[model samples]
Structure formats: C-alpha cells, structure tokens
Target chain A: MTNNSSGSRFGFLIPVIYIVFLLLPIYWLVNMSFKTNSEILGQLTLWPTNPTLRNYTVIFTDPAWYNGYINSIIYVVMNTVISVLVALPAAYAFSRYRFLGDKHLFFWLLTNRMAPPAVFALPFFQLYSAFGLIDTHIAVAIAHCLFNVPLAVWILEGFMSGVPKEIDETAYIDGYSFPRFFVKIFMPLIASGIGVAAFFCFMFSWVELLIARTLTTTDAKPIAATMTRTVSASGMDWGVLAAAGVLTIIPGALVIYFVRNYIAKGFALGRV
Target chain B: MSFSWMAWTLPTAIFFITIFALIAALGVWEYFSPGGGPRVGILRFETTRGDRLFVSLLGSAFIHLAWLGLGGPSLWWALALSVVYAIGVFRFV
Candidate 1:
C-alpha cells in the first residue's frame, strides 16, 4: 500500500517537473525582457531586479519591429484559411471513396509535409521572384501551402474517417445537396478536427523561418526575420531581442488556449 | 549560466528549442493518455510514436545529405522527396 501511494505521488511530480523544465526558458526570456541590457550582460540574476518596460516600448515605437509582427500575422492567417479550405473537400473525398490509386494519391499528399523548408527556400525564392511576388504576403502564404495543405488534409481525413458513412447517406436521403450537407451537417460533426487542423496549419506557418524569410523582403518580413536586426554596431540588443521573443510567443499561446480542448482530442485521436 | 561560449545564432537556437518543445509535447501527450501502443506498419515491425519520429528524423538527415552529395542545384525537389520519405517512414516504417 505504501509503495503504491509513493508511486502515485511521484506520478504528479513527473508531470510537474516536465512542465517546469519546459517553461523555464520562457520564464527566463520574460525576465530578461524586463531588464536592461547592462543588467542582462552583467550578471545572471534569477529574476529581474531593476525591472523596466523599455525594451517593449522600443519595439512598439519602431516601425521595422512592429511591422514585422503585422506581416507575420497576415501571412499566417492567410495560410491557415487557405490550407483548411483546400483540404476540406479533398479530405472528404479521401474518407468517402476508394478510387483508382486513391491510396497512393493520399500518401503522396503526406509526402509534401516531410520536405524540409531549408531545401525549398532557394527554389521558393526563385519561383516567387519569377512571378514578381518576392516581397508580398501572398507569396509566403502560398509557399507555406506546399506543406500545410498536406498536413491539413491528413488531419481532416482522420477526423472524417471517424464519421460514419451513414451520416452522408442519410443527409442525401433527406434531399440535402452535397455542398449544403458539407457545410451544415458534415462540418459540424468534425468541427474539432477542423479546429485541430487549423491550429497545426497556423503553428507550422508561424514558426517556419527559412521559407518565410526567403519569400519576403522589407514589405512583408516576418517578425522572426526582423529579429535579426538586434546585432547592430554596438552589439546584440539582448533586452529587445528577449522582448520580441516574448511577443512572438503570445499569439501561439492564445491559439493554444482557444483550441486547448481540440488539441487534446487531436492527441488522443493520434492524428496530429 | 554563461551561454556566450556556445555561440548560438537565433535560427540555430530556435531549431533546438523546437526539437525540445516537440519532445516535451509528446511527453505530455503520453502522460495524459498512456497507450501509444506499438503497431506494425508496412515495414512489418512494431513501432510507436517516438520510434516513428526518430526514424523520420534520421531519414530526413540522410535525404538532405544525399541531396548535397549529388550536387543538386535546387533543393526544393530534394525537400519534396524528403517529405515523401518522411511520410513513408511514418506510414510504413
């Protein structure tokens, strides 16, 4: 009885420890963001002693810094919407039918997700340049589609497969058209899957640097790319860099909070 | 405490951070629901989530290296090929 009790106690400790380990760097970044560059470079304090919001103020006031955030958000949102929209019908078809080479085709879609962004950075740069899309939000959004579409389709397909064929047949018998049934009954049934797919798409596009950086210049530089400006004549601006890092995490955190339940389900479903 | 000697670039740091984050996320997923039971894929061997992830990462490294070895001018197609390889690893291996 004592051994069992001890095991259970340590079970909670494991997850707690894991959570702390995962969050420590983030907490450190936040702490550093609130300190001066002198304080940061001078010593490694556990927390900020002389706290200030100067770094944040700098970012907010600077167009180069703030515009990066805006550009990143625009492309990330555009990519997520486009990926989900394109995947829905494709996912439905994969789930509902078994046409010739359907399995091969479905597997082919997943292959796109495996490609590393670094390998495609130069090609995407050249392709977008050829089309005069080098410095545009759409270029980044469309390039991201190369991977995000496959992931969206795969996740949505897993969810759609969970839904029974009878639902589709019943909807048809009730005189519902394909598009109407898809929007009304079918979509609602796998709303959580859609949520999960959208979340993944947003995250993949958001954190991806190589492709995003290659596709855009000043007008559409992502926050991650703009972050390189910290290395100036003086030295690295550690405080502002830390502040930018904190800000970059906020959107992802908000996204996770909103789709927390669906993400949990996605993990359980083993589709993510 | 002094990480200066490590000479970490932003992208390199971010890459390591992402790998750690993924591992942590996988740990959390395993904790919440323990049974990520091993299943035999097309490779005819049992594998779990972590196993598949490891295989895919290893395979991607080879794909990239092979691309470099072959002196490919454009790596997009190599990347595309790697994607297919990774998907295959996850699905079959």
Candidate 2:
C-alpha cells in the first residue's frame, strides 16, 4: 500500500495536467464572451473590469447564430440515428454469418471513416447536387453516413462477436423467431456497443465543418458555417467568434462525460 | 449519335476501374493465400489475424492515396473505404 500513494499521485498528475490544458482555451472563450469589444482589444484582463453579456445577447438576438445551432443539432442527430440503425443489422450479419464478399464489403465500408473531409467536399457537393439533396438535412445526414456507417458496423461487429453464438441457436431451437430473438436477447447484449457507436456518430457529425458547410448554404447552414459570418469591414468580431467556438464544445463535452467510462474498451468492440 | 451525347469518358473511367480491380484482386490473393503473419513489432505481433488486419488497413491507406493521386475518388471515399477494408479483414480473413 506504500506505492499506492505515489501511484495515485502520478495518476492525478496526468488528469490534472490534461484538465488544465483542456480548460484554458474554454476559459479564455468564456472570458471573452463576457467582455465588450473595447475590453477584449484594450487589455488581456484576467477578470473583466466591467463584465457584460453583450456577446451573449448578440448570439441570442441574431437569427443566424441561434438557427445555426438548431440546424447543426438536427443534422447531427439525424446522422446518428441513421448510422446506428444501418450498422445494427449489417454488424449482426457480419458477426453471425459466413457469407459471400463479406470481407471485401466490410473493408469498403470502413474506408469511408479515414477519408479527409476536404477532399470529399467537392465530390459530395456534386453528388448531392445531382441528386437534388444539396441544401437539405438529408444531404448532411447522408454525407455523414459515408463516415459513420463503417465505424458503426466495425465496432458493433466486434461487440456482436463477443456474444456467444450458442445464444442464437438456442433461441431458434426454442421456437423463437429471428426478430423476437434479436429484440429480446441480442439487443440487450449489445446495448453498450450501441451507446459507444452513437457517441462516435454524434461526435463526428457534430464537430465536422467542411462538408457540412460546403453542402448547405442558407436554410440548413450549421453553426460552424455561421461562425464564418462574424466578420465586418473593420475586422472580425473576436468576442462572438470565441463565444461560438465555446458553444461548439458544449454538446461534445456532455456526450464524452456520458461515454468516457465505456469509450476505451468499447474501441475494441468488447474484444479487450 | 450526337458528339456530345457519346462523349469518350470511358477511357479515363476504364483506367480507374482497372486500378480498383487490381487492388481488389490483391486483397483476394492476400486472404486466400497463406503466411499472413505481422512482419513488425510491439510487445507481440505475429498472428494471421493481426497481420491481415494490419496489412489490410495499411494497404488501404496506400490504396486510398493511389485512388486520390492516379484516380478520382474524394477523401471521404478514401476514409470510408478504410473502414470497409478493416471490416473486410475481420469477416473474410
């Protein structure tokens, strides 16, 4: 137990350092959000002499800023829902069955995850334009799918493999239908995997800027795109820009807080 | 047929198709043939499954670059294909 104290101290050191590094940018943004333009430019005040919520008011009263948040939420959640659903059956199949072209197909699905958003920006725009889905929520959702689906399938497949195969056979022998078996038994087994996959899907789509901005212009524009509008003839609105950047972190942080416990082991899809 | 209607895009299309076909064939060969053990190290790294996964993903990264450089798919496609190839190793290999 003597080493326990040092081990605990070492452990605290990493997380404490990580917390400070992670929070510094966030703290600066919050500080900027409470200050006026003159204050932000005049000096680097640790505490604002006259803290005002003017930037907050600008964000709320501004239709563009407020609506961007709504659009982003709508598209990201749609992406999450679609990605998780498609992955479920595909993963179950890959784990449970020995089928034709299975390996080739699975790899093809996964390559979508590694793609750089910038390169896809052009082709996706053209592809969506041809399909007449360019400015819609569905376009963003589908574009996101090109990344989210493979991950969902890969992670969920690993989780499915961890489950015992006999479970499936037993249900069938007991006169349970495939649908009944999956709903009652298989689902509960993979619930943790599902949670992990949803978080990933949400995170990728939530933070992504290039494709989301390129594909949508007016009605469906994301907050990332709206963040671009914080420019004027004189210069940029640093306060509002920082505030928007701060706002972007809110959803991702909440999600990680919920999934942080399961994230690491879940990466292997339950293998480790 | 009008000149515009029957434009000759097939040559370029065929070039891309041939490259992809070759990569696919190599994947098939990798899976069907034996001796797929990881070549390098960590604490331990020498199994058919581990090598297949590593080679497949690594090969995929190259394939995507090739796809981008010599061919015309977007980076999103490359990213998407990386996932697809990783899954393929799991299911097939």
Fnat across every predicted model, in order:
0.00, 0.00
Candidate 2 structure quality by residue, lDDT tens digits, A137-168: 98999999989999989988988988999989
Cα lDDT tens digits for candidate 2, B28-91: 7656863443343332544455346556667787978888888775777876877787777655
Please report, as a residue range, the 10-residue window in candidate 2 chain B with the lowest summed lDDT. B34-43
Docking class of 2: incorrect
Question: What 10-residue stretch in candidate 1 chain A is worst by lDDT?
Answer: A98-107
- Give the Cα-based TM-score of candidate 2 against the true structure: 0.75
Worst 10 residues of 2 chain A by lDDT: A1-10
Model 1 clash pairs are: A114-B83, A115-B83
TM-score of chain B of each: 0.79, 0.42
**TM-score, one value per model:** 0.72, 0.75
Best by lDDT: 1
| Tens digit of per-residue lDDT, candidate 1, span A13-132 | 787999999999999999999999999999889999989999999999999999999999999999999999999999999999855445546766887899888888876776777678
